[model samples]
Target: MTYKGNSIFKGKFFVWLALIILAVVPLFSGLYWQGILVLVCYYAYAAIAWNFICGYAGTMSLGHSVYMGIGGYISTIILETKGVSPWIGMIVGAAVAMCLGVIISYPTFRLKGPYFTLSSIAIVELLGTFISNTESLGPVPIKGGSGWSLSQTGNQAVMFEFSSKLSYFYIAFALMVIGLFVTYRMSESKLGYYLVAIRSDDDAAKSLGINVTKYKLIAMAISCFMISIAGTFYAQYFRYIGPDRIFSYDLSVQVALIALIGGQGTVMGPIIGAIILVPLSEMLSAKFAGQMSGLNLFLYGVVMMLVVYFMPHGFGEHVVSILQKAEEKIFGRIKRKAKD
Candidate 1:
């Protein structure tokens, strides 16, 4: 993660390169392949958003699926009942999610390490149960355990529904881009500095007059707000969402796993992680799901375990090292040729 080089090349070139390649991918991708890439972008966006709190701020949350569920439910319900757009739900859900994030962080920020992670899982389960069991929350229909589906608006751009998978892929890809930009910005801000300090040692940061709770709350706010928007995107793309899936602990784990496996807290880590994991999982599912339902998950666990043992910093650290070496060699050769 610390492969220093030319400021501009290290800062921006690889990021834009990754993005540009992804942008061009769909032009040659088929419908089925496009769907797989869509999921990759979706998970990548989730991982990046999760990185804000758990990665940089060093507060582990294994329950971010709660935010995703809240977002999907809000947009789906509004679109179903009021005939409004998911776009509006994205905005409103973000506000609600931010408030909820603050509420959760205010009390639990005192807890650190595994304790905070456990509390978040508990909170997610509590909320997930309530939404799944209850038929209605005030006026909006929860529809109980059966969940709800997004109303079809007939390939409408304003409604966020499209006929082709290409649109969804682009939308998901754009969301990832936005998440990357925000993370990049946050990493350079004063708030980012404070979070880094707190992550290193909260007490030491407190001694330095940093408001530890305030900054953590701010990070959670941004994290929840951004992730909720992704929820809307998921709902629109999938056209169906339920407590069992949206609010599932498994979803949170997937997001966290991707972020961590990618080298959490780094700019391109989650993207790299998604590029590695998503397709592998899909292939596993397609090849093994019939003979052994849980085989893919078992293999996934094995991969994660291996990663923990070998690359504790995830793939990003090594990837950056190699990239820097390659950059040096390439530019070094150019300079030599120019001198010749």
Candidate 2:
């Protein structure tokens, strides 16, 4: 048993080593690839946030993009129009997202399974529509619209604009590191055990003296706050924000898919998922965007289906299991030889 545990620890050490190497790739990669890596970091953060709720709390949400969209729009507006620092704007955005999460949690904590999922989707659509029609907030124009303008030139600290992608990459990488650290702590703490119990069976968990609602709400707040940080990152990096782009259903789906593919309920699942999927998705979109629209999305769908069918627990869990089995075999042989 000790040997098995040591082997598992060694495997995790190597995983962290690999992550550290990938985190520094931007220092040497070209501008274009650096931009992609920045995006990978952003998605990784978002996926980790989603995993907190869906993977750990077992409350799947299809409307998490609502929080992301709100965060992005609010932060961008404050930074661009009101001349606020993006760093401060991020706090405001995260607060708003947390409030929204609280508001939704009150009514939806009673729901489970498909109903909760449907309600989440409805909330996102509702927020999207509201943002689109309410133009009184200083013209939050959609991209490519008649009144849309992408022009921005102002104070460096307030606007969060930079001449180089490297800055954005580093900022995103830092956030990803923070996200992973938080997740690792959460997965090993008492809250994590409660979340697992809640996910396994809410009724059983409730009977065990766990305050299901309280824990769920806490998870929702943490998840939304984390996702909002990613939203701030997005606004700063892209220098743009709109309902369709920031709060799109596609973004929400991407978050969920990343967590699901990597290993739901595991600390490193979302990061693994983002690292594997984001680059692949980027490559496919770049190659097929103009020639075959929708092809890349179709491929994503197929890939998702394959992962669900073959590895429902996700790649991270699969890797962990394999390492455990190998360790067991090695240690078993050693024990037999010692006895002989």
Candidate 3:
């Protein structure tokens, strides 16, 4: 086979191997690690959703948590008030988020760079405040000091509540897999190229007849819908949601940070970021619980600084480069031996 064909085969092999390893993790690990892996999948899925717009389309939104909050609140409210299954609520929440995405894009897309980022921040605060103050929307105020909850109703899969961390892990893993597939598909599509072009130079892309506004909205809608689905899973997993908790600016920043650290614009970047950062954060938090109040967060900042300094393009890209070189060297040796 040609070198390119060989490289593709090697890549696929590794991909399948990694998936199988992840699939079997819960079989050997205890509850704590299972929970950690669930969190890793959740954050990774959110990060991948954020990457579609921020990484590929170059739209830096600092208010994505708004969609998450919306998803959580909508799904929870429907389950409580209408007696509908959360499975149906998940779809409704995503639809609502997609509509919000269009509305948000209209105003914010006109602004670029820091201005857009600032707009997103403002939106987050506005949505949080709105939810907190608006009690008419639901029996329980979504942003009220008390927040909302979902009872452990009958039927695990139907109610979307699970008694086992293993179940949560599998659900989260499935979502993460879906997110990864979508990211890979989008990155390899013509839309992906258009997004990159718009991101690289909007003026140039417009000159080439690209509809910047339409494409930006498309990316935004897809990103919002994906994250909203994650929000639904989060609510079911935790059995609780509050405006302050789900709609925090910090959550938005965390997703962005994950993508940046993992290698934005690449399919594996967010997943890599989550795999490394989530477990580390959990370990640090567990080890330092009550002993060092802010040490874990402090350490996270330090690690991010180091990553920014050393692997500016993202650790994921750097790792990929290393692996490709290693493979090339090994294959080169095999070809040489065959020739001899």
Cα-based TM-score, every candidate:
0.95, 0.88, 0.92
Residue-wise lDDT of candidate 1 within 113-214, one digit each (tens)?
999999999988998888889998787688989988766757899999899999899999989999988887788779878888898899999999999999
lDDT of 2 at 330: 75
Overall lDDT per candidate, in order of appearance: 0.85, 0.79, 0.83
Best-matching candidate per TM-score: 1
TM-score, cand. 2 vs. native: 0.88
- Model 1: pairs clashing at backbone N, Cα or C within 3 Å: none
| Model 2 / residue 179 / CA error / Å | 0.7
Q: Score residue 72 of candidate 2 by CA lDDT.
A: 76
Instruction: Please give, for residues 1-340, the per-residue lDDT of candidate 2 as tens digits.
Output: 1222113354675567767887778888898799789888899899989998888988889889998877777777776677778788899999999998999878987888989998998888887777766765556433321112335664364457777888777788888888877877777778888998999999999999999999999989999999998888787777767777667778798789888888788777888788888888888889877887777567667778989999877877666666668766878689788999
Minimum summed lDDT over a 10-residue window in model 2 is located at 1-10
Ranking by lDDT: 1, 3, 2
Candidate 1 regions with alpha-carbon error over 4 angstroms: 1-11
